[model samples]
Target: MAGSIATAGVVCAVGIAAAALVGIGAAAAESQRAAGIADAAALAAADTLAGFAAGDPCSRAGEIAAAQAGSVTACDIDGLIATVTIETRFGAIPVTAIARAGPPL
Candidate 1:
């Protein structure tokens, strides 16, 4: 009986470990996706801002960034620079990432 109990306990422990590993893998994937989205948004915004001479470039960049990201918490353009931030929840896990791009100053 004691041997059976020990075996059961070991099996349970292994199952728990496997579950934790799966969760971690999922979180990593979500983080990567979020990062990619932010990077693309920042790049698009910077490119757009570069064409503009002046006037509310930040606002315009933000708009472009949000559009590309699908959802963005903060987006802004300063001078020749563009920045974007996005946060999302994937399967009960929260992920956040920021991306920035700028022309030579």
Candidate 2:
């Protein structure tokens, strides 16, 4: 009976470790998604600011972020450069990402 209990305890620990790994992987994927959205939003804003696209820079950034199920919490434009910060949810936690796009430097 003692050996059986030990085996069960080991199995439970392994199962818990697997679950934690899966949760971590999911959070990482969500973070990557947010980063990608931030990049795209920044690029859109930069393109608009550079006159390669027609629209207000921050407005363009908001549109791009919204399409990807994110919200642009902040946007800043400097000359032809654009920086964008976006927020999205990862499970119950809030995930935020920032990106800057502009002429090659």
TM-score result, candidate 2? 0.96
lDDT of 1: 0.74
Model 2 regions lying over 4 Å from their true place: none
lDDT for position 100 in model 2: 98
- TM-scores of all models? 0.76, 0.96
lDDT of 2 at 98: 99
Residue lDDT tens for model 2, 24-105: 9999999999999999999999999888999899999999999999999999888988999999998789999999999998
Clashing pairs in 1: none
Q: State the lDDT at 31 in candidate 2.
A: 97
> Candidate 2 has which clashing residue pairs, if any?
none
List the candidate 1 regions with Cα displacement exceeding 4 Å: 52-70
